[model samples]
Target: MPTTPVVSRRRVMAALFTGVACMNIAMAGASTAGVLIATESPGPGWSGVPSAAGVLGTAAGALGSARLVVSHGRRRSLLITYGLGSFGALLAAAGAVTGLFPVLLVGLLVLGLGNGGAQLSRYAAADLYPDERKGQALSAIVWAGTVGALAGPPLIAPAARTADLLGLPGLAGPLLVAALVTAAAAVVSAALPRSIPDAHPRTPETSGSEGFAVAFAQRAVRGPLLAMVAAQVAMVAMMTMSAPQLHQHGHGLDVVGWILTAHMIGMFALAPLSGRIADRWGGRVTIFAGIGTLAVASAAAVAAPTSHTAGIPLSLFLLGYGWNLVFVGGSSLLSTQHRKLQGTVDAVVWSTSALAGLAAGPLFALGGYVLVAVVAGVAALIPLVALTDH
Candidate 1:
């Protein structure tokens, strides 16, 4: 009898991780540019454009990617999304050079779509492992973001220099760099072996919309989804406004960069430990702990004086750490809930999260930093009320 060929899980995981890291590099770079470009926009209240566009783009991307994953498989979905991201980056760069706000906004939205697709790579990592080890695998892929997060911001200056050499606007440099990195990621994604199994078998009857309907019908699934949404809303709302708030308080750009880096570290550096905690203690316990931490961090942000430099960074770090816990815990729980509807379930989580993020900018504009923090703290408590041990 002929034996079946054995696929190397390690090699496949390595490829996924590499692709994820490259995507992160593009994401981080684009994110930095998004903020700066938004700040430079001529229109009043345009600072939120990128954030809103990001949220909207993510919603669209999540739905589209989910459908593609259901029909075509993960590698093809990733390849297409990354290509979209590269094109978006180029558009953004062009917008920067020409000072076209609409073009820039559109680019940010498309770039965000790319991020949405990359976010699913974590689930893909988990798919390769057994249930008991899913948390670790997911967190390992998430931890890969640390490399890109650390490397991305520092490139701003270098990117500026490159832009000058190429006779482009300085602000356009990061977007151009984003385009290159994401394009490379597309190539890497295209190389992914088709033999790697999906997390769940696709069902022809369950289209993306039907999958959402089915997943949302379950109480167990709703709990995790709500947890993820609250975490994302709170984290993105606060983190998005942090730089401008600090800059308004007279902090330098370099300081903002360092603080953002610290936040990223909090988000990704300790993810493995968070995963282990979830596995050992149960996701419910871990989620409660995460919410508690987030509450404390938000309270700290509200209480700390604007001049207290150390306080803000510390609070941001705590916020990121809290987000990491909830994110990992909630994701693990979701993965276990309905294996067959993984793509749609993930899409719903991201789309809801994106809607919350879209609201964040306007919230900040209307209520200021304190209001954002207060609202985030309150939002974090909703999961506590909704989630129960199953």
Candidate 2:
């Protein structure tokens, strides 16, 4: 067994983390304004665009992942993903200028592709370190995304200002910023050590090629997949309604912003540690904790906003943290379970998640806030029951 080049576990983790966050910065900005832009040009049709775009992105990402795994390999695939991400940003900026809804949709689709691919690349974080520390490393890489996540919406303010100068909405500015972040991530990837798939040539466990069927059959992979899908769907469903829900309860947009910021803060704050816990205790425990937290949070939200402004934010924060924990924990497990099928399994997982979001989005939009939250909360618990038998 050849020893991997020794690097600062912390530095490698940090670099990957920055790399992941940078990839999404643009999309994050666009997401902040997605509904508004949709409503402006397309009217109510815009209401469905975000979730639809999410589905397209997930599908594209699945295809992109397979291609990356086959041709460029993991490291190069990440670089390609970064480039695509940046191009998506540029495309989005252009759409904002011309008011071309189709072009905007196309750009969003491409951005989705990049998002799918960049997120899948996080699984490769396990490759950068020895097996023993893999979970922690994966968590660290994901934790880095928190930086971009936080920056995504906030960056919109300045971006909006910049776009206004160009006679476009501020939305264009964030796309430009996203492009810059993607470019930077690509540069960093160029410096990374080559990525080795979990399945090595010498290992008997290496199955070589993993078609969709085999990947789906694995319990370890399936467990986290369920967790990811549920958590993600719930998160998006809740998030989509955050502004309205807060408003219904008499909270303003500023208060809504505070809730979102707090949610993101909770998500990243515990990620690295969660990763370490996954490494120490295993993915199942962390996932269990995450699912439990989400169930509780959902119940709190269903209870409705109270006089305590902090309650919703606090619940959302826990939701974010719980989501982060489950995702990283599940991702780590999936990486190991189907080493040869990493990309395939990832595609399946994310695509399933995307579809779930697609189904949940409008339902939430039409169902109103409380129903969506309750349904998502209740749904998250289903995986817990099904997977415990394993």
Clashes of each: 0, 1
Query: Please, what are the lDDT tens digits per residue for candidate 2 over residues 302-339?
Result: 77645237667777887788788788778778765444
Error of 1 at 326 (Å): 1.1
* Stretches > 4 Å off in candidate 1: 1-7, 198-210, 305-308, 337-340
Give per-residue lDDT, candidate 2, residue 313: 77
Across 1-390, the per-residue lDDT of candidate 1 in tens digits comes to 222223656766777887778877776667667766776565214555576676667667766776677678888888888899889989988888998978987997898778778777888777777777788988998888887768776677678778989988887898899899889888888778775664444345643334556667677677777887888778877777776677567775567667777777888888899889878887777788889989988998888726336767787888888988988888888665433355555566656666555566677678777887888888888888778645
Stretches of model 2 off by over 4 angstroms after superposition: 8-14, 194-206, 243-257, 305-308, 338-340
RMSD of each: 3.1, 3.1
Cα-based TM-score, every candidate: 0.90, 0.87
Measured with C-alpha atoms, the lDDT of residue 204 in candidate 2 is: 23
